[model samples]
Target chain A: MALRNASLSVNKGEILAIIGPSGAGKTTLLRLVNLLIQPTSGLILFNDVNTSGDDKHQRSLRRQMSLVLQYPALFDTTVFNNVALGLKIRGCPETVIKEKVDNMLAVVGLSGFEKRMVKTLSGGEAQRIALARALVTEPKLLLLDEPTSNLDPKNVSIIEDIVRAANTKSQVTVVLATHNLNQAKRLAQRVAFILDGEIVEEGASKEIFEQPKDERTATYVDGRMIY
Target chain B: MIYLGGWEEIGFGLFRALQLIFSGDPEVLRITLISLRVSGTATLLGAAIGIPVGASIALRRFPARTLLISVINTLMGLPPVVVGLFLYLMLSNFGPMGFLRLLYTPEAMVLAQLVLVAPITAGVTLSAVSNVDARLKEMAVSLGADPLQEVRIILREARLGLLTAVIVGFGSAISEVGAIMMVGGNLLGYTRALTTAIVLLTNQGAFTEAIALGIILLGLAFAINILLTYLQLRTKAGLFAAETERHHPVT
Candidate 1:
């Protein structure tokens, strides 16, 4: 499908990897799913519900889903507070909020970092915190935009582990956009290879990696510059 | 004799002014208190109205926003005398609001100052609110914050600049003589302030007292400037400290 016509369904507990070169409309697709930008003309259905002008519906859809931007922008607050922000917005009770925030931090491998400020965290730590912030609300759909592109190798692995663990423990449906092929193969169960805003290949990650139906997909997977 | 007075005369005037302040002369103290009252009330009233209006304009998109901003900018430079005359007419016997019978009263002076300072307060505050990081606004909305929460976040982030707006309104109100003189009737003991008193003394050819009042006015303005500067520095430091804590988490 073209950018205007493409549609993908993400099942619960599934990690859908959207792999593409630069300017393949991957980020734009994520933004459209997150309601960051409205498509020129298309329908965005969340949980089988059409989200258009109804602010309440849109918010409800977004409340159950969240997008972690490529650049993790932490609020100007301590890490504990940042992680607790989603609960705060939902008006969660103090006792429950405290317990849940503590658990989420521990889940993200940041058990003792509740009091730490977000600014001082390393790249890996910050991404984990960002993930924690998104997961604290327990979103059903988690959209990640190049979440590990900026990290070093060690940090990339750390982020991958965190992402994989989040899916396993929470069963949070995740859709990750990435340019790194290895990452997609390692973490994603299903992969969609896109070029120039069109999906060229889609199937189980291993299937797509083993047998490509399209030459463009083969070349892209083979690391020849196809753009 | 009129022309021969030099440094000695000016020095004597300054001495007498200091003596009057230290002695707490009833008229001088009373006028100072009234000036403070008028300026302080105006500043508060202006801020109360201006902050919300500015914030609304900054946050929401509506038709003719450009025209509204243009009008506010133009009003910021409105002459004091014009405001005075407008208020005078409005509060006069034949004007629409004349039933209040507020002309020449301290309240009238306050009204004039409010009108004069509101634009300054709004304009400054508008610029401050508009300068807040757009990402912050977007993030707040994405997090399900209501409109009021959005405003609170914006105001909290831009508190320093908002304070500057209040200080600017106060400075302008306290130093203006034309509007107060017109609406206040410039009475010797009833509505006189440092600015009106200086004007009255100058008109009466009491050059010594006028010069003395001028020195006091300068000192007051200087003190206000220093206080505002100190507050600005403190606020900036606080914002930076907050930002650092947010960006750089502690071990």
Candidate 2:
């Protein structure tokens, strides 16, 4: 996925929404920023430091960020175990893990779902559990790839509230990728329009949707056919 | 002993088979126990070695991986008699490492069956672990799991498939005849197992006794499969009452 001239900067403690149509490289951008995949040409900077490191270096950097995919790739286990896996890997104490997992589950409005098997959960419940797992780790940067795309309105609202709460309460930086223009407008402080693997326009959320400097951005924001 | 008409022979044999099973004939009991010990040991040993090896092979991406998998798959259908012959030569007095004189022993029988079962378990496990969703590993790595932890999670997700691998191995071990017969020599009250005993009884025209042993073998297979299936589903469904109650006490 060729990403060119996509030079984008995200300030700390703010939601930067990348809005684009399907196959427009939104997931790729998030993965690149998360450092899960290497960019062939561009440099990725996390916290103003060049992230050109070996595998060990990358893993340490990755521990500070969490990526929630469009579909929740939850493990086939109990909800508590799924939410507790990241902490367990970090070698957190059992008491601490239980405390944090419980808090996160409650945060996602899934209190007492600890023993419930993940296989028996509904889509919304599972996504909420996914959010719980991702947010439970308290990552410095939360990368969401269309988190609410497949969710019902109720789940969508709940998830949006959770993300907003995480940013507001923990001061977590967020890079959200979504195809829903309205969702981008609602959740993001800043919005960047991407098309064909290139960033067409970027500005404050209010400004970009209203007066996109690029023709493609304007066309997409107006819900028109853009080639 | 005299040969009888076909339908009446089958009828008499079946009646006597049931009689032997219910009456617990000493010879039948001894043969059944020997069969169980030999096959059970082989299956256990096979599972112990095969599961981890198979899981590790499935996770790796070495150059010889495809070739190794192909070899294992081919070995799954390895002829039992061939294994018996190979082991027979190896354990024979003139062959290398034959000084221990393990030929025609129950241990030799187990060795033969293990050869037959290990490949089956390993091949099935390889297929099972490979069939698990690839996204699971990505998720594990994303969540800070090192490579080892990634494998652990994959194995956990493929637990049912791994169990099936073991069950299939056990099935193979229990039903085998040619290899054990060749190496074990079908020694009465010694290495003679259900299949070998059935063969002996049939050859001697004790058809009813052979049929009895056949029914008992089928019964053993049925019982073991039912037990394993119960464990798999029960654990999966969280219905292990004792464990469940301890972990999740009623509120």
Candidate 3:
């Protein structure tokens, strides 16, 4: 019962934020979208194609998207290898991988840190590397689960700016799940408020946060407990 | 009936064994080298088969998986003598594999040890791969890793554990005497390994040679443990340093 009866649509190149309290199924929703976990029931269509099928099709669809987990699970390797993994999996040439990895690291403010071990990085640095790794492939869609959670203000700002740049410059569709209402307000073009495994309300970001149609959504956005 | 001379004989035997060790006695060295060769071959063969089977069992889900894992775990404790008996029957002249004429040879001993070692290797590898962070697989999938790449990534993360499996497998193979004794027949200058030689020398009342072989066996085990332990410690230290850096940022 992690997620149920939750229906929503995300336009291409749009930034959609899923904001809710803990255990509200925001992460579950993002996982569903990423096809990392399949819905027990319901159809998930990607570009008019159903994604729930054999592994080959799923893999093909997944290559066009990237999901960054909250904890940023980096491989036990160097930053360069971690960032280059997606491109490598796609069979990108060594020269192209090197160039793209370098560019991504630079964009994430980790220009000279390619050779450094991922385990040696601080939390902020590791999170940035995770973002760089996710964005390196220039995915058509980016799914972020609490990307800035537990980071200091500086790291949060850096991550938000990176997400913004990726969306605006690359036109990558983004579906970000976070508990921080303020972050939802700042970043998302549209917002969905989920509670108890269901989307309680959905609309434009400004209307959902400032003029929430549902009482539960209003309570959540107003900083009041709504369990 | 107190056998007061036994203590003096034991002391002298120890002295002679040390002398043989230091003097590079060819006979003693040959026995030690044969022991390593037989056991090393078994271990390599075991790992080559065991690791992939173990990792696959850990990563996949199907009916009877629990039963298979239980069978593997139980086999890890398989008695060496039982393996020896089973192989003895299989490789004997009247048996199905009799045409190969492998019985009473080093090859027969290796086959017996492989039976004893493969399960241990696979069992340890199963535990190691299972202990890897589950989120790592999910992350790999989200990052677009295909099935093969996902396995490669998981195996890389679980390298230390896999090495531990090899060490355990090798240790079991090298230290086992019961199986090899039954199959090898301990032919001198040919099939005789350190453990079998020790047994033969003791039975023939050549206490000095037995003691020498025992000491060399102990030394071999000690050397291997020391090297593998060093590697394990170095890996642990690197991981610890990385963890420390992750938790404490230089701001």
Candidate 4:
């Protein structure tokens, strides 16, 4: 029971941040949104349609979204191949794949790195590649689970900028689960604070951070709540 | 004087073996070619059958998986002579499979090697695939890969182990004399292989010829294994270098 009674909705083309103390089921919420795990008691509606379908339908729904984890988990291959994998999975043409991958790499500031092997990449570069790989497919939805927690300040700023641009320019809805409160306020317009597998506070970032309706949310927002 | 003479015989045999190999002595070449054909075919078939079974058993969860893996590991250490004797019985004139009449043929030798190699290849592949990071699968699925595509990624990641399995299988198939000798009949210019020929030469008291053939057999397996090992090491060196740099970054 990683998550319990967690009801959340992600508005399309908007960034929704899930902020909470550790073990508040941020990852479970993201996994549920990604359809990686089915909820036992609740229904997920994507585009006004229930996502409880057969395997093919489930796969189809999943393909429309992408998830980036705290750990990049890039393939043991060239950067080009790693970024090109999603486009390749969609069965895009070779020219289209090459063009898309190259453009995505450039967007992530890793231009001309097509021939570089992934194992040689630094932690930041690998995460950027992971982010590039996720965003390359132009997925309708992007679920990021603590995507920048392990990153240094420089890489974190680079990643946040990239995510913001992707959300604004591509109209890709973003659901970000993060332990960083400032990051949630910086990037997300609307934030949901989950505590103990439940969303205790859900509102605009300003309201949650300044005038939280719940005492727990205020303590958590004040950074005094210890796990 | 006798010990000195023994050393001279071994030195001369080594020299003669090199000459036979370099000059392509017709008999030596024939035996070598026959051995390669039998072992090569058997290893090819073994890789085809073993890699899939090994990879499937590693990635997928089902009932009796541990038992199946145990059975495969046990099969890997089966003695070549015992396998030969069993195969000889099965392919004999009055045996159940005797209707095919594959006895005493090169095909029979191939079948024997196939049996010995398949389990070895499968077992190695199973171990290798199981060692791949479990996070990779979840990453693949998160990137929109379906089950089949996810499997493709896993197989790609485990490519090195698969290569090792084939090389090991080929080594076993080419070196084993018992199974091929019994099933191939060790006929002159037809079924005769390096090991069988070496045995025949030694029995006929042709010590120099036997020694020469033995040296060539050992040299051939060593040369092929070295080549594959060099390729493996080259790739591994790159990975190790990168991993070391990641762990111990220079100031």
Per-candidate TM equals: 0.83, 0.90, 0.91, 0.92
Q: List the residue pairs that clash in candidate 3.
A: none
Q: Runs in model 4 with CA error above 4 Å? A: B2-9, B226-251
In model 2, the fraction of reference contacts reproduced equals 0.34
Question: By lDDT, who's the top model here?
Answer: 3
Worst 10 residues of 2 chain A by lDDT: A54-63
Note the Cα lDDT for every prediction shown. 0.81, 0.86, 0.87, 0.87
The CAPRI category of model 2 is acceptable
TM-score of chain B of each: 0.88, 0.90, 0.87, 0.89
Indicate the docking level reached by candidate 3: acceptable
- For model 4, residues B33-56, the per-residue Cα lDDT tens digits are 998899889999999999999999
- iRMS of every model, one decimal? 10.5, 10.4, 13.1, 14.5
The Cα error of candidate 4 at residue A65, in Å, is 0.7
Number of clashes in model 1?
A: 5
**Could you give the CAPRI-style class of model 1?**
incorrect
TM-score, structure 4 vs. true: 0.92
- DockQ value for model 1: 0.17
| Model 3 Cα lDDT, one tens digit per residue, A1-227 | 48887999999999999988889998889888899888998999888789988888888888889988899888877888888877777777778888999999999999999878888999999999999999999999999999999799999999999999999999999999999888888899999999999999999999998898999899988888646
User: Is 1 or 4 the stronger prediction by DockQ?
Assistant: 4
The residue ranges of model 2 lying beyond 4 angstroms of the native Cα positions read A48-52, B1-24, B237-251
Runs off by more than 4 Å, candidate 1: A102-128, B1-21, B202-251
Identify the leading candidate in terms of TM-score.
Answer: 4
Top of the candidates by DockQ: 2
**Candidates ranked, most accurate by DockQ first:** 2, 3, 4, 1
RMSD of 2: 4.6
